[model samples]
Target: MSFLTFGVGPSKLSAETAQDLRNAADLQIAEISHRSQAFAEISRRALGGLRTFLRIPDSYHILYTSSASEAMELTIQSTVELASFHFAQGKWSQYFADIAKHFRRRVLIDTVEWGQKNDFRNTFVPTEADLITICHSETSTGVACDLADIRAVRHRFPSTFLAVDGTSIMGAVAVDIALADIWLFSVQKCFGLPAGLGVMIVHERVFERAADLIARGVHNPGVFNLPAMFTMVQKDCNTVATPNVLGIYLLAQQMERWNAQCTMESRERETREKAELLGRAIEKSSSFRFLVRAPEDRSPTVCCVRSDPQTITSLHALCRAQGIELGKGYGKLKEETVRIANFPAITCGDIQRLLQVLEHVRSRTPAA
Candidate 1:
């Protein structure tokens, strides 16, 4: 039997956690009264705890949904009044742009070559539009954008509300909620919980815009309605219709536990250390090269790598045989790249094990 490889999230839960979840299941509340005071308290505290962990300022508002993708859709469909500027190079980021097009929104898309740097600052202006979207960490290529750089660009557009998809980096990486109008992600990714819940931090100004759109009847009123969500969230009630109560309970417990041990600084350091450790191995391995064009822009969580196609194939086989599953390259970049996730749950030993397998695989193959 091989050790489980950590590619994305949902690798494993803490030992004590599994027990707690089983216990909660035994005492599971048969009737989930959404209006119950108990549920309201849970929702209230969960939002407070989540916002505290994210270091959201008083100017921001927090909300919950079924999934992070839902949060993204809500933010996009509700208040995207003018035009949207999308800076994307990865498969997932490209998908967000497609989502905007499906809604018939005016979209300006700027794409850099895979692994290349982009200057969104030069292309954006306050006069151009008020709705701008960006991805904080691109999992597809394991590249991260500088948040400070992005924030600086946003400073030029005081009226612009920035929407960020922070799926792979929110809890694991430090984020300033003030820099964004809408920052969203799922519990499955960085929160290290089950995938059903999406946590969103929205600025009050953005909420106002959403409300205005709702009043004007310009925004869709169904699943993507932010105004309706805001009402439920403000009252600490459920607008989610039917929530995954067990999953959310697990999330709440995990978030509280994570809050006690995981600070943004410390977790970011851990992420950096793991990335550096694996990067050293990659640098020393003559058969491998990082897929990201620049070292500074590479992500601490997702590590994208490249090698000769045959060698990459052999390495993949070796890794899978050894019980270390790797992520395949995405979209136009698939043939030349592979991705490894160094999420918080993945230990240093895990990285070492994968490196050992990689080295062994390289040794058996003839060097190009």
Candidate 2:
């Protein structure tokens, strides 16, 4: 029997994506050399598809990594010299801040409550900070910071390198890519693909910053650093190491499918509609309410709900027993909330089925 899980990732794959994987294996795509011309064509096609699908500007350089966590590490190591500032709301944003601190860089973090949004208007970054980081969509709490907020930060701090973690909402939402110096995401979340590939769209300013750091001898460009990655991309559409060939192939195929069927604008509208439907259904039920209070702040890709510990647990079990799986909450809210994914791969019918199960469960449970 087939099952649907609303977990953040690794999300359910579409039939076409799965079939493409089988086709790749039949052709031995993964066994081919990264230096081979076949791989070059794959790389070129994938990059071209992403550029068209996302409207990535010609000024930005795209690079691939193992995961978004590695993207965070590489960005921090390569660009940040002395300090970094973070507008943190959830676990992922806080983790990025911790990664900066682990590099021995001074980190100044302005944090908000777990379920609340980050107030960037009152927040200030120190002049000493060379980099500023924000999670565009905080998967842990299902709160997405507005692109306008990012643009405002860029206007206030023109010289600082801005990095955004668009992990869970990249492909599903319409983001203003030009607003940030670096935007990164993993395909596992919104692209409905297997994990292990992270995409980073970097502005030329980041490259210049890395070069300046190298010139001053303040930071060594590691073998896997951004400059080195850029060099590899320029040379052969490859990486410093043997890349995930299958992942690249799958992403390229999925991107083309998205482009042909639903443009990003239409996808964003459908996603918002589905999220509103789910949010309203949950609000009407006594067992669950949205974790994010402000409707505008809630994520279109990931929906998180709050309820009592026992009720949340019971709901999870009920869904599982019915061949449906729901995501458990993350961090401190683990016992108090249930997380649901609203990715492009999950259809409206899937959500309707989930609502039916939720209603059935709610009718039997006592009001909290």
Clashing pairs in 1: none
Off by over 4 Å in 2: 363-368
Candidate 1 C-alpha lDDT tens digits along 82-107: 66778786866776777778778777
The estimated TM-scores of all candidates read: 0.92, 0.97
**Which candidate has the highest lDDT of all?**
2
Model 1 spans > 4 angstroms off: 1-3, 9-20, 29-32, 124-126, 363-368
Worst 10 residues of 2 by lDDT: 359-368
Q: What lDDT tens digits, residue by residue, belong to model 2 across residues 288-325?
A: 88899888899888899988788888888889988989
Model 2 RMSD to the real structure?
A: 1.5
Q: How does model 1 fare in lDDT?
A: 0.75
